[model samples]
Target chain A: MNQFNIDIEHTGDYAVIRSDGYINNLGGEKISEECCRLLESGCRNFILNLEKSPIVNSIGVSILIELIERVLESDGKLVFTNLTSTIAKTFRIMGLLQYAGAFPDELTALDEIKKM
Target chain B: MTVQEIKEIMLTVPMIPDMELAVTKTVESLSRFIPFTGDQVDEVKHAIIEACMNAFEHSRSADCRILLVFKVGPCKLTVEIVDHGKGFDPALVEDPKIENKLFKNVRKRGWGLKLMKHLMDEVDIVSNRNGTVVRMVKYADAYRKEALNESV
Candidate 1:
């Protein structure tokens, strides 16, 4: 099944990527590409909305790490919002939580990013 | 002693990352018949994804295939993922948890094996000149008890 897609929305200084599917290799690649595209457009801050994505593999997590690195290189911040409990736990185990912050909703994430 | 239904499923898929969804979904569907809690099901799905992804990534052969065998018994569920590719010793692989540098990097790979071992009740990896088979098991009774205790 084609169980991965993303929609990008620009809000002032950052872009929110709403991902709708399992975040595996396919989903991860799409997210990385979208983030890179946005980075080139001078959008450094990012809020990744993952409420629709309940599952993510290590490959997908690795891809997210790459995005985090890219954002850090640009002195930008990448935050995660609307994470399922499973994904949140996985991210914590993989050390993604150390490099990024996760909020319960997108508005909170956006508010935090705006302050940064 | 208790008598419980036993069910088995066999699935074969190409060695590609995108096929992970199909494998996970099939396992989730079959797990409904068993007594897996929501947390247990998530753990099972994560472990299965890692096994399948490892097979697809490590198997350099263009025509490599992955075989999944799932067996559900009275109190436990076991899944075996077999891949036809060059295998490495699981013992030789360093634990990502022990290696603090790996966790610090965040981008460092090798979390797959660690996660599979952590999520499942038991994990066995057998690799030889033929191929590698990763067998993982989860105990329904244990998780069910944990869930029940949490609700208490």
Candidate 2:
């Protein structure tokens, strides 16, 4: 099993966390840590691109929910871009849409965040 | 004859060996009926592995065997994962959507179940009466359309 890869890229005002591989318990923790590190660096806007990632378990999902809460608490917004349909549905059922928003592609998510 | 021709298949494996690969291939083979795409297949496989691993670790059986039965129908595919252990309560499990991070550790066992429910069309479990039987169903429509475009 390959641990998920997280790449942090900053474009002026927004930061993107591009993840690849299975998002299980370990992957979830890694993602959470990365998000926290970015927040500490004064980068609040986030766009998670899960296009290369195929499967994400509940652990990953919970970590995402935590990220969403943390972002909201700091008046920052988190958007998920390029979600696989299964993940999109999972986010929906988990009611993540109530707090976080999703876009079909990364560019759109970035645009949405800029507008906010 | 293809995987679609088969009705049911039973697999019993010792919990000591990590059964993730076996369950992944088995479920992928049955994708003919469920019509899951490569990505959907991966999601389902991960969920099953998590469920089985939980049984292998937390369940009270020292040397227990896990039984996975698959039933393939014309319109749906169903899987029953059974373990002879102390069993758990499905109703008591909290929703993973809640922001309470405190509950994550306590309900770590049910994480697989939650993903299974989210990935599959239906998920039902019977616990305590005769151990735990996790039932997962995937509709043909979910896979058939995708199958037409991709090789299963």
- Which structure among the candidates has the greatest DockQ? 1
Candidate 1, residue A27: Cα displacement in angstroms equals 2.1
Q: B1-152 in candidate 2: lDDT tens per residue? A: 25654688999878864355568789888876655566666667766776777677666654488889888876567788888888888888775545444224433224555667767766788889457888876666555556435533
Indicate the worst ten consecutive residues by lDDT in candidate 1 chain A. Answer: A84-93
Clashing pairs in 2: B35-B143
Badly placed stretches (over 4 Å) of model 2 are: B1-5, B12-22, B33-50, B53-60, B95-115, B142-152
In candidate 1 the C-alpha lDDT for residue B91 amounts to 92
TM-score of structure candidate 1:
0.85
TM-scores for every predicted model: 0.85, 0.78
User: How high is the CA lDDT of each candidate model?
Assistant: 0.82, 0.73
Instruction: Report the Cα interface RMSD of each model, rounded to 1 decimal.
Output: 3.1, 4.4
List where candidate 1 sits over 4 angstroms from the true fold: A1-3, B1-5, B61-63, B97-107, B141-152
TM-score of chain A of each: 0.95, 0.94
As a TM-score, model 2 comes out at 0.78
Model 1 Cα interface RMS deviation (Å): 3.1
